[model samples]
Structures are given as C-alpha cells and as structure tokens.
Target: MAEQGPHFLMVGGVPRDWRDKRTVAEAVFNDPLPFLDVESAHTHEVLSSAMAAELVDLGEGIIDVASVRGRNRLLTRAIAGAHYSGVIEI
Candidate 1:
C-alpha cells in the first residue's frame, strides 16, 4: 500500500469591496506536523520561530500582505495582482 499524506482544507475569500484589495485564505490540515513541511528550500521562505509564534497570536497565521515588508511584499503583490486579474482564484 502507498503511504497516505495529510489532507488540507483550503478556503479563500475576497471582499466584495476592493478598497482594501485584500484576500483571506486559510489552510486547515488534519495533521499539524505536515503544515510546517517545505518541499523545497528554493521555493519556500522559512519563517523564524518568533515570527511563527507572532502569527499564531495574530489572526491564526493569516497575514495582511499589504502590510508585509521586504521580499515577501513583492511576492504578495504579484499574487494579489494575479488574483485580481483572474489568473488565479487564491
């Protein structure tokens, strides 16, 4: 038998109003351990332990990409643009 993997329930929403230009998305997993697994270092940015803790305290890991700084900000902007353009849903 093949090994089974954790399952994730992903939900995403965009506000009816575009004033804030923000999207809310969540990934709920059956197992918490798999949530921290990164398939590739080049494709993923590892958050510091402190940062992860902070996110857990603040909105349960949901981030306001507009308020993010540095390289992540750029990545978020691209994703947001793609979402708005209908290239991607979430």
Candidate 2:
C-alpha cells in the first residue's frame, strides 16, 4: 500500500498583523494591562494558536497552524525569536 495524502503538512507561523492585532504579545512583553481582556475571538469563538502559544510560553517545536491563513516566514521568525525556540510547521 501507499500513502494517499501527506503524513504531515508543514507551514509557516502566524502573520505579523494577525499577532499584533489579536494576541497579547505587546502587553506580555511591553505596555501595561488596562482592561486585562486581550483575547481574540473569531466567528466560532476559538482561541488562536499564537494566543495559545503566548499563554503557555511556547519554547520550541513545531506549531500547527493549519486553520490559519496568510502564513509566512516573517510570522515564523517572530514567534521563534520571541520564544527563542525552533518553531516550525507540522
């Protein structure tokens, strides 16, 4: 037998705009917390991977962003630089 599809599809990380507008990276690293409510909710009300990573302080390993759009190199670099981890796509 042979595989029909990719066992693992690799992608980049979260976009700069998406993270800047949605996640609490700025607040966590800089700035002050005024409202303390920085969660970004889509139509389905689901937390983004970037937010989740920030919350948990993602250090390393591949980040699965299959549901997100506009993934690119800059996003990956930003996340990796922030966490100082080797973040890749899975």
Candidate 3:
C-alpha cells in the first residue's frame, strides 16, 4: 500500500513534521488540547516544528501517536509519553 498524506515522526522525543506516510504510520498517536483545529485541512495551519516538539515535551508519557514501527515515530513516542488515555478527534 502507498501512503498518501502528510506523515509525522517523533524526533527528540517529540513529533516533528514530515510528509512521509510510511514514517507516520510506524508510530503511535497524540492529541494535544491546544493543537486541535479540525475546521480546515486544505489550508496549511501554520505551526513550527519547535512548537510541536515543545507540545510533545510538555505531554511526555501522556499521549500516543504511533501507527507502525518507524512510520509514525512521533505517534508512538507520544503514546509512550501520555499521562491520560481516551478517545479524541482533533
């Protein structure tokens, strides 16, 4: 199968930005409270990698964004870093 969207990865214990689907799927998943913007997906929501990293750092052991081994490193790291667990769509 071919991955077809912007993928994310966990770097430096945080989720960084990348368009690689394979890399985004190999990891867990995370959902930040302040980062939720489901209104628009076509227009790029401006957010820096540093900010994202900071979010992950703040949410350490409190979230999971992983979907595969290395595909979604950030997701996986977030999952490992989560403090609370539940369902959230953002």
- Per-residue lDDT over 1-90 for candidate 3, one digit per residue giving the tens place of the 0 to 100 score: 556445443355343333354373564458544444323432112222323564465443322222223454565444333312322223
Candidate 3 Cα deviation (angstroms), residue 14: 44
Report the error of model 3 at residue 10, Å: 44
Q: Cα lDDT of model 3 overall?
A: 0.37
lDDT against the true structure, each candidate: 0.40, 0.39, 0.37
Q: Write the per-residue lDDT of candidate 2 for residues 11-78, one digit (tens) a residue.
A: 56445775578765543447532321222233112233544555344342333443223345544445
Q: Which stretches of candidate 3 lie over 4 Å from their true place?
A: 1-70, 83-90
Q: Pick by TM-score: which candidate is best?
A: 1
**Model 1: lDDT to the true structure:** 0.40
TM-score of each: 0.22, 0.20, 0.18
Per-residue lDDT over 1-90 for candidate 1, one digit per residue giving the tens place of the 0 to 100 score = 556445432245433574255547657887543222223332233332323554454433533323343345444454344434554321
Lowest summed lDDT over 10 consecutive residues: which window, candidate 1? 34-43
Give the worst 10-residue stretch by lDDT in candidate 2.
36-45
| Model 2: residue 88 alpha-carbon error in angstroms | 16
